[model samples]
Target: MISSLRKDADIIIKKSIDAVLPDEAVKRALKGFKKGTGKVVLVAAGKAAWQMANAAVKEMPDISEGIVVTKYDHVKGNIPGITCCEAGHPVPDENSFSATRKALDLVRPLGEDDTVLFLLSGGGSALFESPLIPGEELQDITKQLLACGADIVEINTIRKRLSGVKGGRFAEVAAPAKVYSIVLSDILGDPLDMIASGPAVPDTSTCQQAQEIAARYNLKLSDEARNLLGKETPKELSNVTSVITGSVRELCTAASNAAKDLGYEPIILTDMLSCEAKDAGSFLASIAISNSRKGDKKLAFIAGGETVVHLKGTGKGGRNQELALSAAIGLNGLSNAAVFSVGSDGTDGPTDAAGGYADGETVSDLKEKGLNINLYLDNNDAYNALKAVDGLIITGPTGTNVNDVSVLLIS
Candidate 1:
């Protein structure tokens, strides 16, 4: 019974991810875009950068030259006329600084009539960084925010201030050059300015908000970094045309449809599940147990959103993996039930696995192997724990970024 349900989960995961790939969506967003009389150059950044740039050049083959800065290993194949550079993600590195300089240089020479085709996506805040402070300082600030369990919006709010390219500053740098931005949002509610720190869109986040986040999180910042936070970001940008495509909401709906196709009554719990990873997992398991009581009827419950992980221990795991590990503890002996979570981008945290899986049998299996889920959870080491039970879900890079999805299945 568990094996059959596992197959169902795999099918649902594949279909859901395939449905949200940026290829078709990028093409749709570009349908009405016409290249200006001036030269058309492309700058793509984020986890989805390479894929989005590939789609753009295909649709508008007249693109003269382009640059793509994405997570390391995310650049699969090269696009002609586009230089693809891999960079650090969730944290910016020297490659990020150099790639961003290349982009800034590309657009600085453009005339008023020139069009800068900007392709932005989720990890852009890190992958397309040009820090006003030292690169080491910027990396340190990012680590502080992540360690403090700051959400994406709050993290990006602080990040926008320090970055030379973010917070509508890239649009500012393009100056007279028209920026046609196509964004694939991974943040909840699609806050235009918060997604990828709004490189092209006018920032709605203010200095006060950024400062408030710093205070709330007790973030450790250098004097230079704190001063940047006080400086306001661009609130108005007249040279950019922005279009947002794809989000976690779309991801949830696709998962629901896939679950229905598998003969399970699918219920989309929420598309904005923001909370601790462990809590989300436990909640999903509770729902699975509740539904399992209604015998013999298969059901799938889906929740989609980005969750946070507070680093209590030096655990090597992402939120999705932590979420699944927590669910395993709750699922312990629940019969014919299972839970799984995956990132739409095909990589979760610093690990290779997209996320993880936890079924009723997981707890017992771990016990037999002298593994305690609680200890792993305490250390935030869901990756190794899940690995021991063959629960790690590795999909490599899926060429998309749309937050994450967690599913509860009762058969």
Candidate 2:
């Protein structure tokens, strides 16, 4: 039974990630693209930057020049006329700065008749950075926010004020040149201003809100960063036209269909799940337990959204892995139950694995190997624990980012 569940889990996971690959979505979004009379340059940034840019070049092969800034190893190969540069993610590094500089230089001299086909996606806040403060200081502030469990919107709110190219400032830089921005949202509710810190769109987050989030998180900040937080971001931009192509809702829908095809009754619990990673996992396990008692009706419960990890320990793991490991505690002895969570981007945190999975046998498997689940969870070591139990789900660089999806299966 567990073997069959794993097979079904694999199918659902593959289908979910494949459905949000950004290739089709990018091409669809570009159907209405109105290329300017002057030079048409491309600037793609985020985890999905390479994939989106590749699709655009194929769709409209006459782009004058291009620059793609994406997370390390996400670039598959060279695209004609496009310079693809890999960068750090969830935190910015020197490569991020260099790549962003190249992008900024590419569009600085454009005139009113030119068009910047800006392919924006999740992870762009880190990939597309141009700091108002020192780079080291900006990285430290980002680390502080992540450590404090700041949500994407909250993190982006603070990031917007500190970045030279974020918060509609990129649109400002490309002024006189039109920016046709196509975004792939990873945030719940598809908030245009918060996704990838809204490089081309006007920011609605204010100085007061940024300061308050800093206070709430007790974020340690340099004096420069602190001052920048109080500084205003661009509240209006006139040169950018934007459209959102895909999000977590699409990821969940794909999973639901795959599960139903496998003969399970699929229930979409929510597409806006936002909470602590462990709590989300536990909630899913509870649902699994309740439904396990309802006889032999196979069911798949799905939740889609990004969850935060509060960083209570020094060990490594992403929100999705942590969620699956936490669910193991409640699924210990349930014979026909399993829980799995995976990131649509095919990378979770700094690890190679996309996410983690657990079944009824997971607890016993750990105990037999003399590993305590509590100790692992306390240290936030889901990667190692899941690895030991063959529960890690690794699908390298899926070329898209729609957030995360967790599924509960009872068979």
Candidate 3:
């Protein structure tokens, strides 16, 4: 049964990614571009940065130059034409700083006769951090936000304010270069301005908004960040063509199809699912329980959205693991029901495990092993909690990212 669940999850995730590869999306979006107008320069940053760059290269073989920054493990074998740099994720390291600087340098020399292809995806915010605020201050504030369990949207709202190149500044810097952005959106609803803090899109969020978000989460930003947010972005650089090529919709569609194939009635609960991890888990569990009571022979509920975990303990896991574990605990003894949550990128939070799965019997299995789910969750240790019951779903790297997908199956 566990093996079958894994297989179904893998199929759903892979089909979702294939539905929105950057190459296919870019080709469709570039249909209006006039031939031989100017040189094409590709700049990308994220877990799928290399794949996006490769897609661009395949589409435009004669492109002049390219630069991409990706997470350490996401960078596969090199492409001879494009320069690839591996950097840190969830937090920006010195390498990310250097890579950002390099990307900036590559774009600074662009001309009106050139077209800049910006490939943006998940993890780009940390993978290409240029601190308009002091480096130390930015680092401190980022740490606080992560520890506070701030959702991606809130974290990115603050990030855009502190960075010199985020919030459409990258497009501003490459002014006159005709920016064309292809994005694999990880944010719920695929907000163009929120994905990777909108490097190539205008930012409507204000300094006050950033401060409010920080205050709401009890995070204190440095004086530098506060001051930078006070200034207005210049108006001369607003030329951007942004296209969202991927999102949670793909995941829901794939999961729905997978369910149908498995002889189950698939219902997409929501594509804009967002909330605290525990609440989301419990809500899904209730649905599963209700469905079981209806005497449904087979049914699947699909949802796609990112959830947040307030870090209370030093647990090693991502949001997906936490969600799965919470659902397991909520469903304690329900029969023939299972929940699986996974990040489409094949990663979740800071852990090596992609996500986790939990069934009606998951809680009992953990209890049998003398594992305390509450204690582990309190310590933010969903990774170990799920692993104890063989619930961890490990997928090294999917080379693509949309967002988080949750599947609840009742049989």
Q: Write the candidate numbers in order of decreasing TM-score.
A: 2, 1, 3
Q: Give the clashing residue pairs of candidate 3, or none.
A: 313-379, 315-380, 315-381
Per-residue accuracy of model 2 over 1-411 as CA lDDT, tens digit each: 998999999999998888888999998999888988898999999999999999999998889999999999999999999999999998999999999999999999999999999999999999999998899989998999998999999999999999999999999999999999999999999998899999999889999999999999998887888889888888888898999999999999999999999999999999999999999999999998888878768999999999999998999889999999999999999989999999999999999999999999999999999999999999999999999999999999999999999999999
Per-residue lDDT over 65-115 for candidate 3, one digit per residue giving the tens place of the 0 to 100 score: 888899988887877578999988888888888999998898898888788
Full-model lDDT for every candidate: 0.93, 0.94, 0.81
Task: Decide which is better by lDDT, 2 or 3.
Answer: 2
Model 3 score (lDDT): 0.81
Between prediction 1 and prediction 3, the one with superior lDDT is 1
**Model 1 compared with the native: what TM-score?**
0.99
Which residues of candidate 3, in runs, are more than 4 Å off? 1-7, 17-23, 34-36, 234-236
Candidate 2: which stretches are off by over 4 Å? none
Instruction: Give candidate 1 regions above 4 Å deviation.
Output: none
TM-score, cand. 2: 0.99
Looking at candidate 2, what is the lDDT of residue 343? 95
Query: Which candidate model has the greater TM-score, 2 or 3?
Result: 2
